[model samples]
Target: MPYDYKPYAYHRPPGLTAPEPRHKVAIVGAGPIGLAMALELAQHGVPSVIVDDNDVVSVGSRAICWSKRSLEILDRIGIGARCVEKGVTWKVGRTWHRDREVFTFDLLPEDGHKMPAFVNLQQYYVEEYLIEAAQANALIDLRFRNRVKAVEQAADHAVAVIETPDGDYRLEADWLIACDGARSPVRAMLGLDFDGELFEERFLIADIEMAADFPSERWFWFEPTFHPGQSALLHKQPDNIYRIDLQLGWNTDPEEERKPERVIPRIEKVVGHRDFRLDWVSVYTFQCRRLRNFVQGRVIFVGDSAHVVSPFGARGGNGGLGDVDALGWRLAGVVRGEAPEAALAAFDRERQFGADENILNSARSTRFMSPEDGVERLFRDAVLHLANRVDFARPMVNSGRLSRPCVYPLVAPDATGLPEVSRPGAVAPDAPLADGWLLERLGVGFTVLAIGCAAPEVPGARALALPVTPELAARYLGGAGAAVYLIRPDQVVAARWTACGVEEIAAALTASREGRT
Candidate 1:
């Protein structure tokens, strides 16, 4: 079934007639990142106003793969379960060289976590679900068709001149988040440009509605006979939709290649049949680029406005969600006057680290997938040839190193014998508890997780003490009898100790809250 492109109703804002009160935060995009930013802020008791030029969701099935970390962040904002139920879930991926299989990987071999490895849902459906959730939240004021025309930054606040259907209006806010996407006008208003590499390669993305018996696993072929000297990718989405990506050299014209006449025969060769209806077709050339600094004065950038990667790793959307997760609580604190404005520096620093990590990985994958003529091509071909015979070479296969949350480098308290998965600056690993789950207990605030020990009393922090289950012991208390973990508001482990006093825990909590960790 085709998705309904229902437009959101736009009403005249109060600023059209007269000046309105300053908002705590003003978001200038209604895409996934902007909508999720509003919801995440609302979760922290901060109100935000979201404006976008478009009233409808994305036109095509863009950004179909959602990572597990992204789903966890979405669950916090209230749409993860719906996306999981509606999307096709898969954890395994197979990489092939021509007709022979070279390597396969299971992203999530264990079953303790709540979200799966990856969910293949169209960008439109996720936006619809987020829009519904944002509408229900009283703290989020969503204004559709309100495009940002001009932006002015002051010493303490930023103002956006919004052009609406009725008239132009000026909206002021203490912070302006630019989630307007890859070609961000806000970034241009601030005279900022991305600094990175743009690969000279193009790929045809076609979403075809077809009924088939293919398994729900990612399939990537290198130099396949069907495509002939090019790479191809296949994935199954909901509503009998299958996404196909065929690599086209830099010389091919995008406009001519996107035509159905040019796309249908290529897809037919890959699928070996003509029983498919083309849902959406697009030809894209991607780059792994990002801004040097995500924060500039009172204005901040999130999502693609801050960074953009190739479509292969599913990093673009997921990395944007990572920015939302990292910024929401800190920005809320700064707005509420609970924390100094300097705390935002940490958000800027950490997310910059994340964006660099994403760009590095994406660039490497792009080089591997579309290598140059000489030594680069030789390396890729050698790895692929040896991958099938040698176990050591199997890990060299790089079919877009699937997106995973980047562990921020934090200088904080830590102990040696604990598991690396729950180390400082890394997200806390989920474990099954006696009742629900570990992450469920670690709400949207600072949490003191004491495993196999009593939690110490810390002001302004929730403490949870639990007996050691096998999963908890293995993940949190490796070789140690008891451990205490100080978790930040975003669920990243701030500090950990085998045994800690109340004063140590208190000091750690203060550091984490102040973004010192």
Candidate 2:
């Protein structure tokens, strides 16, 4: 079965003939991160121009797993539901050794949350949904077939030379965001380099469509009989498509391994027959690396351009979305003149912290999966052998840590009574409200979520008061009395206090904007 990769119509830009005024923000790349970043900005009433080299969504099922935190960000832009509806929802993951089950884990144990633990949706589908939703937002000006050849950053603005089908054009933007993926031209143009580890191991990744009744759970095998000594992972996706990854040692030639002849046999071994059709196949090596800083003067890097991680943990895409969430409020505030230029420093500081966390986890997973000979391999094998027998050893097995939201450390006001889930510096947890979910009630702006009490009116923030329900009490109030929470536009808790006044709340808001807190 082949995917219908439709091409988007590219409108001839006026920049080719005449000089246009400077745009507030110019985004490079139209993948998930760039599109999401553009949409997030538009939600904050900021217009952006997105320029990409290609018109079609990704050809392969590149990033298939969308974390709950990513879904929450997508929900903010009104595409979360659509993604879930078209995605395969799964929570359970099992690990096996030589056809024998060793460990099983549930991603989400409790209920009541609207989103599942994770959804397996192809990259193209997610991009198509984002592109469709973006078209409705007039603030988003998408230009396809426009590839950036060179970029120069001035003191206050950035200039890019885009080579379009018609001709080359010069576009200037106040802030140029490079979401241009792993091999970013913008980063290369700036002569910046990523500082981290690149694993020598390679894995053959493939998407197969089959009509099988496999349970919607992640199945991983360590030293599977079919692929002896190597690891294997299976995940279910929408439209009867299943994603399979087989560990091909670093010695194997990727070009030879990706051939359909070689790939077909691997699929047959995993599925037990030649009943499945290969939808997509590729070979990739893992790397856990990121830039020293996300921001560089008038130019900023987001998504893969800023950081990259192994696919094992699903951190690459989700971590990029974290960059979007952290950047949206601060960049919007800076562009809108509501916050100082120093606010972008917050985006750099917080997202850098996130990149570090992702790198640490991903690096560990990579090492566990691809250990060297001697003590490393010995310990890895021991953990797998003992994992089936003991509970403590099970935790040592690192198939993939899976993506989770990184909690940024905050120095804002707080109290001990509130639950740690909604503590300052964490994304505000979701609970069912009367009209909608707690996340739905907190609109795109600076908000004060007051539980069990009236919210204090801050100078430039919205105050949302809610009656303490059981779920709300459990998530937000804990054992404490009425409290106020200062939430940023991205639904991140900036600060919270059990007895916060207007002055304190206002100061916290300032700190959040300045990236100080």
| Strongest candidate by lDDT | 1
- Please write out the lDDT profile of model 1 over residues 1-517, one tens digit for every residue: 8889999999999999999999999999999999999999999999999999999999999999999999999998899999999999999999999999999999998878988999999999999999999999999999999999999999999999999889999999999999999999999998999999999999999999998999999999999999989999999999999999999989999999999999999999989875899999999997999999999999999999999999998999999999999999999989988888888889999999999999999999999999988999999999999999999999889989999999999989999989999999999988888798888889998899999999987887899999998999888999999999999889999999997798998898877667787
Model 1 alpha-carbon miss at residue 310, Å = 0.8
lDDT of each: 0.94, 0.91
lDDT of 1 at 139: 99
lDDT tens per residue, model 2, 27-77: 999999999999999998999999999999999999999999999999999
**Model 1: number of clashes?**
0
Supply candidate 2's per-residue lDDT for 433. 76
Q: Worst lDDT window (10 residues) for model 2?
A: 107-116
Give the clashing pairs for model 1: none
